[model samples]
Target: MPLFRSPTRCIPVALSVTLSLAVLSTTVAAQGVRTADPRASLKGGVKDAQQAIKHLELVSSTPKVEGWFNPRDLGDFGFANSDLAFQKHLVFQGGWHGWQAWDISDPKAPKRRAAVVCQGGQGDPSVYGNLLFVSVEDGGGRLDCGTQGVSDTVSAARFMGVRIFDISNLDAPKQIAAVQTCRGSHTHTLVTDPKDKANVYVYVQGTGGVRSPNELAGCVRSPDDTSTALFRIEVIKVPLASPQDAKVVNMPRIFADASGKVAGLWKGGDHGRGTQNSDRTDQCHDITAYPDIGLAAGACSGNGILLDISNPANPKRIDEVIDPNFAYWHSATFSNDGQTVLFTDEWGGGTQARCRATDKPEWGADAIFTLDVNRKLKPAGSYKLPAAQGSTENCVAHNGSLIPVPGRDIMAQAWYQGGISVFDFTNPAKPQEIAYFDRGPIDPSRITLAGFWSVYWYNGHLIGSEIARGLDIFTLQPSEFLSKNEIDAAKLITRDELNAQLQTKIVWPAHFSVARAYVDQLQRDKGLSESRISAVRGALDAAEQSSGGPRRTALTALATSLVQDVAASGDAVKVRLLSGVVRELAK
Candidate 1:
């Protein structure tokens, strides 16, 4: 079975129910969508478990081309525009300050057209119109690694901020401006104001790292000194058409309570958890903005915050949700209707950083939560991934988005190793899985030769990003398309004939059906290849006791032997089974 529901964590994502169902309505007036308005309140409760929506659909999965991406890690995903049907390109930064853009117009077989390499760490890419913002930070932005110590240089370059690029040219994107706001820029988001004539705003935020050597001396800070950046969310306004009008403003004050402390309630105290004034720094990771509503959502380290950016220069936060369970809230996305917001956790760091000795959860430290935003942001319900119970240390939900379905009540999301899942959210509290595709276990010979990292829809096709592998493309069969031609009943085969002629290569619309096909064929085909199977089983048994397993080498030879047996008997079923397992192991 596919991994769907996730484990529980400490947090809330939306509004309380006393307000009425109007809060969940998708109606929009001149002001904008009702529930989305910063002034309007969001009200709703977790859906009941018994109300699980039914008939989830799985279009297809193509694991043959997984080796294309060939990278160690994958970060955020950005589309050309909020309404574009296909992604224009994708950018990622890590290991080496690096960036690459692909012509994803062909989502399944995207080609890398251009790449920019940097030395320090480069994070997510934010795009607006023709301009792109790439975050860069190098120990104070200096080019001196030999002279000053590496740590000191990195701390000094707190000069980290966004690097601007002019992507007017699809083939050759040029760098138009590199703006530095505050000390460092960790992640930035691009916003466009529909009310204002084609105007854009860039919110460049920083992860408060150690600034000075004194603070680095001991991981402790003087509580009286309010310089710890852990609580600040900076805003830098940049005109989309005019680059010269750029200006930086401190916007964290909007979310700051009367005492000047961020509304977020901290847990684990200041010792291990970094406080703004403490020697360590806090992380304000990813933020998503809905310009039409003058609302922006932030996935802070341990909390989720909502800000009102109606006054571009002076923003105000109307509500917030905190989860002490998740070590850090990493990414978030709003439903197309804007009534619900989905949040995910980056739990890997908590187990390693805090040094908790308890066994981790099976799907590891990842979970998905839904929030209601009518009156104020409040928690609606939550779900966990990987049905198994133990901690999933590495495989986590890094970044995900909800597919826009015009009138449906279900939602779809992608997990790194968990593949993609489409769920029915009519019962928001107990969201049940309708469809899923796990990459299965890691196999060297599988398509791109890596784990599935990112999945998005482009040009009506499902595009998957497999780091250290290539892209895997899939789409609904021609017969599944809504506009497909209707077939006559006379051409269809009977159930008995279909069962008798069942073949391994027959493509199915769902994963469970696909699994059943393979399992059934395996049982039927085993009877006809008893001698051949016995030989391979003998080799596998012997290899298990050998010093270095020769199972793969033996498997290839066995597959070659089966090919001959199939050829002599004209048995395609045995050939397909032997070939798939052999290809996976031999590679």
Candidate 2:
């Protein structure tokens, strides 16, 4: 659910009048009517209401882009907020009302498999094999999963923490354990050990208020109290063979200050040069763990820090950074190379229209950073949605994941009511939007606080969790910006399961598609002369058509010549990569 805030004052009569005008406009548009001047209808209204409606009816997209919207279940409450996890052809979507499992065997027409009704805010979920882990932070959550809700603060029926479920049978998921925490798990990251395959570790990041001592023993809220649990994150260890034994193994104070005061990190303040005031960093909002590289990035409230997770049980802070442009550190994503990190700022707590024309471009956007030779972070650049949204729409940079397009860093991101944006950031210094899908505000009369909560590329399609609408599926099509060969190359890289936070190195198969993808990128980036590119393409085509020894010899000769050309041009990276492809072709 969205962070609650006071409603804006408005006259009931004026709202009714505006709604009537909107209805009239929709009716007129439905009748295949066109006004003499389209801009005439948008002259005087409540902050571009007419223009917002026009955008809703006619959306912009790339050439062959197709999208499907799967509405929420009949009895779900509140808006959607959190990440999405996938297994095979199934998608698990979490909401404040509960979690739903959708069988996306036909992504164009997804069918709901199950709906589990459990009241929890920010029900972020992740899956591993047949196990599912959901974070529950709302105090109203009950142990029995009842709809009555909990009233007594100290009631034993109250349940807030991580809920584990056995999902072997999609139709009937059984709750196995509920690991309780001091602040309740707002979000959690799944970490696996290479040596210890017998168990999995979950780094629980809770951002809510602390539970009372009467409700949960030893939960102190005072910053002065060294024993306070508010400034630490919980690490839960779950035995693969016996998941019921899941329990908190460690509570590392990763936010501790120099004086050993865990609650004294990143005191909130404005950064003087008219920048936004920063939120106090008490706990992390999200953490992206690249276990393959033995590192993780934590997006704490006011600070972004890197961690050495060589020991999954006790992660140590390696470096920390602060940004004057960021108000709230919301989420983190790592580049495929693991050298760059992108952190999003949830300005206005994700409820206000921060993407309005008046908002600062860098305030609620992604701040890019690259690790120096010493493994310390250095500011690279920032990216925000280029399209301006109406004031009634709450838009800000939220959750997103990298699109595995072979040798590129492309991301499909969700920006609340700002709709979906797919952009290429391979050149971190100058990231640009390549494709987008946006609609008018959900309500023309006022703000509805609805849109995509998370959009991720899983399998071959882009799946998104819509806050008010439901599940959405999209596919990238060939356009001026993206080529068919590039799309095909991305499709070749598929996964059995996907969890956005757990970063994995993508390795495409050694096929002509992979080679062509690089060629397409080189053509787009203008890395080589057109005549040279044409010659290289001709050689590749001949090599692909030839058989056995002739094919190998042709590819080898072309590879050597291309390497020489690229080397002369001072592009050692491309030289080595093209050489490797030639070696594979020879094999």
Candidate 3:
């Protein structure tokens, strides 16, 4: 039987799922959705499964493109969908069998506009203007994007590292450049220096084993070797005017200690007998660069690092922290204001189930940290999927992006088969799950390595890269926790492009939605008195209905009244914010 319960329930794409990983063995099949939680015990299937959604609506679920998935096994690793990149009205979703471009102009019905067939394991991509950069780390990757794997121990035919494509024409993307690296680019982050607009920097994060010197000269790795490429990240400078000439510029040893030792970071091994054994901090699995604040949070193999990327070419490590509960530091996401950073731990490497009943909540979870003025990191708490899933589901904290909810630190994260969770982390010490959408399992009778690889918020909707299923798009629905005003405020913040690794600051305009969002937040948190809240809402409604002088006068009067309310309000900051937006609305 076909192995997939992904897009089967939704809309079917071209070509049926022909790949089969493992036949349904009665013993290895998913057992009962592990009904530890009474609220959710969804049935499982690769074609059709029971879904449990809350406060989020699935706008569309597109199946894998025809040629991309002749996946040999059930896990679908060879050609699984990877990370995502957005531009214009199209979403560039990376897949091992090259990447597919989906036109999301109408998110309700996303259409596959283009596909590039490049055989690689993890096709993480980032887009800047007309250039689309993809990470190629597969040993079989060819220079010409051929399906035939290169079997040479040392041959010029093999290509590894970052590939730059001119996506000026989406239907027919042309490869412009391929900058080879020592270990290949497992993932890369696009960074920028406010001082330099002529060029953008790509922080090449390679976690794969170092290539032989013959395969790629200058590539060396040894425990005692001083010139080893193991402990440093390669930075490629892509000139906007001439992206085809992009080349590796700096290989900063950000892990070095005060003694100038390149291998000064975590040396690997478990912190204690009960702790999760972690990998050594040699290379970064991923890096989230918030160029707006000159900060980048790197989830290195063994350490969660903070880098000062003021000089995009040469990032300097400002601080580093390690968690005993973490098995692997996989990815990071910074708060909108850069005051907080959340790092995910990919315990089972996104393959095995880590959200089982025996699993620890702290492991394979997201560790939240507060960044003080001195660049010091203080651990706040950790969050994992609240409900325990069955063993058949390979679930763990994978990839996610921040939801621009004005005053809140909310994130929409993918937990493999555990599903997509939207949580509020404004209070790092006490993070809470506000919304979630989870399907049972791929097979109720077998273990399958499939689910969301990465789910990110871009423009106004959440776009997810399902490992086996395909592209999934979702829109936030207003609930008690997330009000329509807040959702509207978030939608007001739009972007031309979005690369979760390279975060763009969310700036909401001076509109009535902004003021209403603040008002909703105030009422939700009991920040304002009910009498005052109703009065303010009435004033806002009157102002919104009027025009010109009448609206301005009404808004100004409300803003003045809010100044007096702030004295008695519990959440003065948000009240002040509401008043500020009200004043702006009047202007």
Candidate 2 has which clashing residue pairs, if any?
Answer: none
Candidate 3's C-alpha lDDT? 0.82
TM per candidate comes to: 0.58, 0.88, 0.93
User: TM-score of predicted model 3?
Assistant: 0.93
TM-score, ranked from best to worst? 3, 2, 1
lDDT of each: 0.42, 0.75, 0.82
lDDT of 2: 0.75
Candidate 1 local lDDT, 529-549, one digit each (tens): 556545655654554444334
lDDT of 2 at 300: 85
Candidate 2 structure quality by residue, lDDT tens digits, 1-587? 24442110001111242432233233222322122323212322222334322211121211111122124321134445356898899888887777888888887567777778776777889999989999988888887778688988688998889999999887789999999998898889999877789999999988888989988998998867888877788999999999999999999988876677786556877555555676677788789999888889998887888888889999987777776667778888998889888888888777778787666666688877788877787666678777767677878888899988877789989998887888877766677677776666766566666777888988878887777666677788777778888888888988888887788878877778777877777777777777877887898899999999999899889877877777554345665676677668867
Q: Which stretches of candidate 1 lie over 4 Å from their true place?
A: 1-97, 137-159, 181-183, 208-224, 262-264, 267-282, 350-374, 389-393, 440-452, 476-587
Clashing pairs in model 3, backbone N/Cα/C closer than 3 A: 4-46, 5-46, 5-47, 21-74, 29-445, 29-446, 30-444
If the candidates were sorted by their lDDT against the true structure, best first, what order would they fall in?
3, 2, 1
* TM-score (C-alpha) between model 1 and the true structure: 0.58
